[model samples]
Target chain A: QQQVKQSPQSLIVQKGGISIINCAYENTAFDYFPWYQQFPGKGPALLIAIRPDVSEKKEGRFTISFNKSAKQFSLHIMDSQPGDSATYFCAAGLTGANNLFFGTGTRLTVIP
Target chain B: EPEVTQTPSHQVTQMGQEVILRCVPISNHLYFYWYRQILGQKVEFLVSFYNNEISEKSEIFDDQFSVERPDGSNFTLKIRSTKLEDSAMYFCASSVRLATNEKLFFGSGTQLSVL
Candidate 1:
C-alpha cells in the first residue's frame, strides 16, 4: 500500500516539553522517509528524515525514530517552543520515484 | 539557497472555465513535480516532469489536467475545465537529482478555487 498514516490529528504541548507524532506505512518499497513542517501560509519544509536501515536520526532538537519491522516512524521535538506550532507531515518515497506519499498531517500547538 | 516559486497566490474560477497554474522550480533542479492538497487533506501527487516530458502521473491527474515545461524554467499545470472539486492548494517541487537521500524544495503554492 502507498498510504502513510499519521496521528494524532492534533497535539498540544508546553514549553520545554517533548512532542511526538507517529506514522505508519504499508509500502515496503519506500526507502526514504522525511518529515515536513508547514507554517499557516507557507509550503512544507523539510524537518528531519531517516532511512529504514537506521533506527533513529537526530537533527538538533528534532529526532526521527524509525522502525523497519513495524513499518512505523515518529518525530520527536525537544524543548517545544511556541514558534514550533505548525502542521507537520510525514511522507514516504522510493528511490527514482516521481513523488512522495504524504500523511494527513498533524497540527501541533506548543503553549507557553 | 534557491527555492521554487509559484505565481497567483490565489485564483477563483467558475465551473467549466480553463485555468493554468504556473511554477518556476529551483533553477538547477532536474526533477519537477506538481502536488495538490485539498483543505485539511493530505498532499496528493499529480504529476512529475523530467527532460521536458512527463515521467509519471497519478490517477487524480485526468484528461482535463495537463502539464507543460513551456521553456527551460517555467512548469505549468493546465486544467482545461475546472470543477468545484478541483479547488485546492497546488504545490510545485523540485530535486537536484534522483536518489533516496535527496530532499525536495517546494514552492509556497497556488490556491485554486473553482466555483
Candidate 2:
C-alpha cells in the first residue's frame, strides 16, 4: 500500500516530559523515512530521518526509532519545551523515488 | 543557507480563470517538486520534475494542471481552469539529488483561493 498512517492526531505534553509520535506504513518498498516539523505559516522543515539499515538515529534531543520488520517508526522528543510545539509529519519514500508518501500530521502541544 | 522561494504569497482568482504559481528553487538543486495541502488536510504530492521534465505525478494532478521549468532558476505550476475546490496552500520543493535519502527544501507556500 502507499499510505503512511500516523497516530494521536493531537498530543499534549508537559515541559521536560517526553513526547512521542508514531507512524506506520504498509509499503515495504519504502526504505527512507523522515519526520518534518511545521510551524504556523511555514513550510515543513526536516527534523530527523532514518534508513531501514539502522534501528535508531539521534540528533540532539530528537531521536527516531525505526522498526524495519513492523514497518513502523516513531519520533521521540526528549525534554519537550514550549518552543517545540508544532505540527509534526511522518513520511515514507522509496529508495529511488522522487515523491514522498506523507501521513496525516500530528499536532503537538507542549505546555509550560 | 539556500532556500526555495515562491512568488505572490497569496492569490485569489475567480472560477474558470487560469492561475500560475511560480517558484525559484535552490540555485544548485537539480530535482524540483510541487505539493499542496488543503486547509487542515495532509500535505499531498502533486508532481516532481527532473532534467527539466516531469518524472512523476499523483492522481491529484489532473488534466488541468501542468508544471514547467521555464528558465534556469524558476519552476512553475499552472492550473488551466481553476475551480472553487482548488483553493489550497501550494508548496514548492527542491532537492540536490534524486535519491529519497536527500532532504528536500520547501518554500513557504502560495495560498490560492478560487472564488
Q: What is the alpha-carbon interface RMSD for each candidate? A: 1.6, 1.3
Give per-residue CA lDDT, model 1, range A1-112, as digits (tens): 4489999999999999999999999898899999999998788888888888899999999999999989999999999999999999999999778778999999999999
- Kindly give the stretch of ten consecutive residues in candidate 2 chain B with the minimal lDDT sum: B95-104
Which parts of model 2 have CA positions greater than 4 angstroms off?
none
Over the stretch B1-115, how does candidate 2's per-residue lDDT look in tens digits?
A: 7888998899999999999999999998899999998887778999999998999999999999999998789999999999998999999999998638699898999999999
DockQ values for all predictions?
0.71, 0.76
- The sequence of per-residue lDDT tens digits that candidate 2 reaches over residues A1-112 is 4489998899999999999999999988889999999998788889999999999999999999999889899999999999999999999999888899888899999999
The lDDT for every candidate, in the order shown, is 0.91, 0.92
lDDT per residue for candidate 1 within B1-115, as digits (tens), equals 7879999899999999999999999888988889999998899999988898889999999999999999899999999999999999999888887524588788999999998
Model 1's CAPRI class is medium
Second chain TM-score for model 1: 0.96
TM-scores for the candidates: 0.97, 0.96
